[model samples]
Target: MMIKQVFAILAVFLLFVFPSASLKNLTYQETDKVALNVSASDPDKDAFSIRYGSPLDGNGQWQTAYGDAGVYRLNITVSDGDLSDSEEVRLIINRKEEPPMVTSLKPSTDALSVTEGRMLSFSIAATDLNKDAPRLCLVPGRPERFWGEGFFLRSRLR
Candidate 1:
């Protein structure tokens, strides 16, 4: 009876120690819609895995599919004699948005407009990647290096 109880406790410990519900395997085509590269890893080596929309469950072992363009779901499952479980992962396939273009740069050429009246001033244009408004920065020439480039960047000037 004591041995039986110890065996039961060991079984329960093993069952809980290793997370039974396998964290699903997934390969998103990049949520940004650029392209998709398959990446995956399994601790328990669950048999069922979906990579690039190719189901690898049969003797064929590996197959390839040109998954649809959009959010994709790769469902995963694990079974170990006593119990089984599953989970779904998300992958978004979208076009890669180009980085914003620096269309132009307008510098003051003269520092009279600046409070410092240092006679060295400038301005520029910047665009954001993904069309999500742009950000800018200017690094003024350090005092030691007065002969400098954009020490002050005026952001959100668009």
Candidate 2:
């Protein structure tokens, strides 16, 4: 009985002295070039295994993409057979800002010539690398004569 009491006290002391596994939350942008490295540590010098949910590669890294902007809950756990620790990591992925590119302008010339009572038409093409819809609009407070025939043009690129 005395030996049992001594072992019990030793176990309690070990619990107070040794620390468990720990992890921290992360936030990243979808356009970030760097990879997200999920790291955890155990101070007991025990062989442990880490378990994290999807979107993480084999090396426990994540390379974000354009459409990956969202909040994720990762249940990360580390276990050393007898003792284990778990953490609910909140990961926030922010959207990347990208501007649209004008691909081409029809009538590809600095000047346009038109005759009286003749109809004139031109077009503009644009694209967005982020897969966002593109919108075309003339600058506000422009001269009404620039838009002859009271026509306004707007186009969306797929």
Top lDDT hit = 2
Task: Give the per-residue lDDT digits (tens) of candidate 1, residues 95-151.
Answer: 444556666756534232444646754555766544557777655654432324545
For candidate 1, the lDDT comes to: 0.38
**Displacement of the residue 112 alpha carbon in candidate 1, Å:** 13
lDDT of 1 at 34: 21
After superposing candidate 2, which stretches have Cα over 4 Å from the reference? 1-24, 33-46, 80-84, 110-123, 138-158
CA lDDT scores, all candidates in order? 0.38, 0.55
The TM-score values for the models, in the order shown, are: 0.27, 0.55
Q: Backbone collision count in every prediction?
A: 7, 0
Q: Pick the candidate with the highest TM-score.
A: 2
Superposing all C-alpha atoms, what RMSD in Å does each candidate have to the true structure? 14.1, 10.0
Q: 44-103 in candidate 2: lDDT tens per residue?
A: 455666655666654445666786888777665566666556666656777786777778
The CA lDDT at 26 in model 2 is 60
